[model samples]
Every structure is written in structure tokens, then in C-alpha cells.
Target: MKRAWSPGAVYVEFSSDPRDWPSVGVALLVLVGMGAALVLSFLVFDERRFGCMSGIEIGKTLVQVALRQLAQLASKNDEQLHREREELALQWSAELKAAVPQAVAYLESRVDDLDARIAELSSDPQLRRVYTNFNFEAHREAIDERRRMLAHAAAGLINPEITVERKARVERTLRALDPADILMLHGANLVPGRMRGESLLGTPSGGDDNPGRMRADLLLGTPSGDVLASSGCVRMQVSGGGAGQGVWTEVFITQLGLDVLTALRTYTQNRKLSFVVPGREYKETDRTEEAARKILAALPGLGDLVSWSTRRSSQVERLYDRPRPTRGFAVLRFRMCQWQDWKLRLENLIPIYDKAEVNLVVSAEVQARSRDAKREVFVAQFNGPHDLLRYPADDCEALWT
Candidate 1:
């Protein structure tokens, strides 16, 4: 096949912007007649498909092939763009779709920060304080003196004068002993228990507790064992000081105190640790005849309403078997009015005076009928040491009797 240039004129006028300052946009423009050789150069022969020719058929086919390639390129570009969009959607919603850990990485990072903060706070030594509010520095003098006296007393119990065999036996006993062996403050050293089954408070039966008793229930039961052994209270406290220090309270720790005393009695058999208490009776007492006078004086007067029947025994004494506080408290019958400086005072005291000397107990009653007067009063009581923060005699009769 032979191809010829059709009757068509090709025209072009190159233009330039004045801003570019090009004096000429088209360097050359010419119109020339195509010779037969230029036409033949592109001549397409049907017999030869791969030959280089500038024929109209070849040029048309070339243009058609380029257009097809352009269409394919456009399709490929569209496919690539679609893939890119899908990949972006996957990156954003992977957590919502597949539940991958990376999806929650941002939230997990914040959670990790909180856990680290908690761990740091728990590990800080300042936060693990076992004892607080002793005013250790303020009363160092008195405390030091008391500590010295206790050291002396302890030394006397394990005196050097004792034979070596006896000392060894005592040491062995001490090693095996626990809190229960103590008669008073017996197992005061409430350190953690060791791997060996022997408890720090050391008694095997340390956790047994009784429930019928109210005061007996406030004790703490830890893994190591029980402390503050409960004993039925003997005396009632009158009043106490400080906030939450109310009177009309009961102190339940006879069992614990007795345990501590028992341990002491065992340790210091030969040497006795006897100290004068205000009202408690111990095994050792001076049998002076003057004591008889004191006892008689302390006795109730004849037909006196105050001294009618002092004999008292607890009914549910057995509930204090395991020795723990009620994990609770009771309200006092008598309370101080807002006008009083000592807002709440204990109407009763359990004068331990030795072990857990005095506790700030409080009790409250919405309506307490005055014994001496025909009036209902709101009453609260606390337990602790109290001084003159006194009420007038007439007021006591009228308000609390």
C-alpha cells in the first residue's frame, strides 16, 4: 500500500508572554512541499508488518497503539490509587477490625504510664510506715528513761548470775516462743512471720476469736497471727482527750494483756517484774496492815446506792476466745454540748495503764434521759486520760448525772 499526504495544511504560531522578554517565540517556521522520498519513508506495505516506515497506515497504527497504551496507563494509575486508599483505611481502622495490639498502642501507652506511677508510689519507703504519731522527738527524754528501765528489767530476767545451762534453756525457750506465750504485751513485736511455721507472735492458736463480746472484736487478725488478745473488760473508762476521744467507752484486751503477762512470768521466773498500779491487783503485794485501812476506806459506805453490788461477771465471756475487736464500735450515752471545750468525754475507762494505756473511745446517743432530771439529752462518751476539763456539779447532775 502507498500512502500520500492528504490535501491538508499544517499551521503553528508559537506565542510568548511579554513578561518573559523573549524577543521571538518561534525560532523558525517554514512550509515545504513533501517529496516522494519523505512520503515513501512512512509507506506501509501490507506484506511487511515490522518494517520501519512513515506511511499513513503505520502512523495511524502507531497513534492507535499509543492511545491504547495511554488508556492502560490510566487504568494502572487508577488501580494504584485505589490500592493506596485501601492501605490508608487499613492503617486507621486495624484496631477496630482485627483487634491487634498495635491498634490500641496509644491507649496502652497511657495505661503503662499509670501502672508505672502506681509501682513507684508503692515502692517508696516513706509510704510503708508501720508506726506514726508517736512524737518520738518531742518526748525523747521520758521515752528514753522508760526504755532504759525496760532494758534493766529485761536484763534482770536473763541475769548473768544464772548458770550457763539455765541460760541456754532460756534462750531455747525464747526462740520457740510467740505472742501467745506472752502474758502482757507478750507478742508486741509484730514483725512478719518467717518461712518456718512458727509464728512471729508464735502461738499456733493465735487466730481464735470470740464474737459475743463487743470490745473483744476490734483486734486485728493478720497472717502472722493475732495481736491485742481480747479479754473481758474489768473496769470502765471515764473520759479521754483529743478528737475522736470520747468517754463512756470500754477497753477489751484482758486476753492479750494476760498473754503478755504469762510470757513475762515464764521468762522471769526467779526475778519478778512487779510495778505499782493504781487499782489492779497482782500476785505480789505488801501485806502491810495499813493496806487494810486503805481497802476499808475504798469500800462502799453502809446502805450506799453507789456501792450496792460491785460483784460483776461477764455472761458471754467465752466469745473472746480468738481476741479481736468488733471491727466496729458503739456510741456513747453521754455527749458534751457544743459549748463545752471538751466536746465529748468518756463516761467509762478501761484503765490498762500498762499495755495500750488508754484509747480514745466515743459513743453517741440521740436521746439520753437524764437520771436526775426529767429531760432527754443527746449524749456521747469517750475513753482516754482526762484532767480538769470539768463540768459544774449541777450541770453533771442535770445533763449526765
Candidate 2:
């Protein structure tokens, strides 16, 4: 057999011999059966792979199905997320709506108070300066009732009496103090005191030089019952005792302290709190004053110490050295001989010495008029034989004279 290829067909040539014919006939039959088998195989395989659809059509269908399923899954997931988000928003909205009105009302009442204050200030021409000077923004968040009332009362004071600068300072000071610090002034006396020192070289107890004992008086009495020597409310004096020969400390309320206390007392009276009015009750049982008198009586002094309750007392003129006059506490004076005896007696007076030191004042320098200045001022205790005087003492001033 021979074969040639045309554009689309195959040509075959066979030998004319009968032997060749029979072989050729058998080969032809085999070729036809093989071609038929191949056709059948193609049809069966097409049915199995694509289920009667063409390859391209089947591929398109698969892509559509995948896209449709993905879209459905995304839509379901989005709906689930949306439902959860909506539920949370509804809960939060309900809670906020229920609570917001009460918060708004409370804030509105505060605004109304501010408005009333503004109206009151504007009505008085004299208070216009205070209105202008007051820093509302700085004090906007101030919530303490006592402090707020104090500030209002302080502002209501006539203007010329309190200069613009001083008023501004007082306002700032008012806000700076803790409520307890302000309240503590109720126990402190207005008897302006000082802290002073003297040379202990010539004194009898000077030889026993212990620095700790020298300044022990500073810790004797604190207003807050703490070790603080001076709060900003009180003035502080320099404690000078080169290498601890002798040191004195005293406590006195500041002008600002006095003003704040007075204002709070005056304005906050009807309210919940009030300041203690210092007089008969405060002076009568005052621990420091009582202790001083007990200590003085026990001491082996020169003569009987005179206490003049009234200016017209019969013994007033006899005292060539006048005793100091203070506003809130009693005054006692001890002479040089008296100081010596007092020192000797202090060791034996265990009751007064060992008692808790409350209202026992330290000292500081202040304006002369602000304090009681006199000769023979009350001396609490003389550390040595020399002299223990308050700050701003005269030269060689006797301890108590």
C-alpha cells in the first residue's frame, strides 16, 4: 500500500495481485472498525467530561455558578453584620436618651446660677470692677460650696476698701488653700507672735549644747497637730541659731488667712459650716494659755505675777512694765529673775510639759500695727538664763521684760 496527502484527504494505492488483494481487503476492514471505535470513544468521552455541553459553554456555566454562590454568601454575611451593628446602636441610643436630659438639667441650673450672679454684679456700679476682675474661666469648674460662697462674699465687699490688686491676690489665695487648711485657722489665735533667738553663751543651760533641744519648741504646738512649722496661711520667721545655740519659732495667722476666715464665717453662717468666733469660749479653756498659767504658778518667781483683765484694774499702774495685749489669748510676762526660776521649775512641772502641744504658737515678723507690741511681753518658756524673746526683739531685751 502507498499513501499521499491532499489539502483535506488521504489517497492510498494497492497492488493488483489477488494475494495482495485479500491482504488489502482485511487491512481495509480493520481500518474501518478502528475509525468507528474512535468515533464512539469521542462521543462517550464528550458525554462524560461535559454532559453534552461544549467545553467553552460548560466553562462559562461554572464561572456563573461560582460568582452567584460567592455573591449570595457575601450578601448573607453583610446582612448578619448589619443586624448586629443595628442592635448595638439601638441599645446605646436608648441609654443615652434616658440619661442625657438629667445631665442637661443639672448643667442648666449651674448656668442659671451664674446668670444670677452676673445680674447682681451688673446692677451695682461699685461692683463693676470686681465683675471685670473676676476670672470666671479660671474658676469655672470650682464646685466646693464653702469656697464658692466665700468667693462670693469676698467679692461683695466695697471696692475702694480692697484695692484691685489686693482683691485679685485675695481671690487667688482663697482658691489655693485646702478646705481643711482654711478650717484649721479657727483654732489659731490672732495674737500676732514672733520667733526670735538670743546668744546662749552666757546663759546657765548654754553649756549643755544639744541642737535638738534648742529648736524643740518649733515642734511643740502645730495647728494641724502635725509637724508643720508654718502653713501658707501663717507668716514664718527666719530660725537663726548659728550651730544651734538657741532657736525660737512662733505662729501667727496671715492677713489673707484672717480675711478668708472672717469672710467664710460671715457668709457661710446660715449654710452648713461656720468659723469659730474666737472669744470667751475659745480663750477660757485654751490649752496653751491654761498650760502657761499652770507653769507660771509652779515656778519660783520673784513676786506674785499680776493678771489684769480690765484696763482699770487697780494693779495696772503699779506695773511699770506693761504686759502685752493680744486679741484672742492671755498675756503673761516673766522678768530676768522670774525666767531663772521658771527654768528651774519647768523640769518639775511634768503635767504642763508633757501635755500635747495644741495652739502653742511659733513666731514670725509682721507689720507693727498688726501685732501687739509692748514691753514685758508674755514669755512662754525661757530656754536658758540669757533671754528668749519673740522675733524683732530690742537689743538685750530681757526674756519677758
Model number with the top TM-score: 2
TM per candidate = 0.15, 0.29
Evaluate model 2: give its TM-score.
0.29
Lowest lDDT block of 10, candidate 1: 314-323
Predicted candidate 2 versus true structure: per-residue lDDT over 1-401, tens digit per residue? 66698999998788887768877998887775565555445543545667778756765555565558669999999999888666644543443344334333322332335445445645766455544434342234344443344444444343223344555555566555544455455445322222245322333333322122222332234344241233355654545467755655444456766655544443333333234422112334334544544544444322232221111222121211212232323223332222333344444543443452423232211122225654332233322111111211211122222
lDDT of each: 0.30, 0.41
lDDT of 1 by residue, 1-401 (tens): 11245468544344455643342422221111132334436656555674655566565565566558669999999999888666543443432233223223322322335345445644644332211111121122233333222222222222222333332333333332333333223222211112234322232312221111122122232221232322221222333345554333332334324322322332333233232211112234333435433433442221121121111111100000111143322111233223132222221212321233223343444454467776544443333211110111111211110
Once fitted onto the true fold, the runs of candidate 1 whose alpha carbons sit more than 4 angstroms away are 1-47, 50-54, 95-401
Off by over 4 Å in 2: 1-129, 132-139, 189-232, 240-245, 259-401
Name the lDDT of candidate 1: 0.30
Model 2 gets an lDDT of 0.41
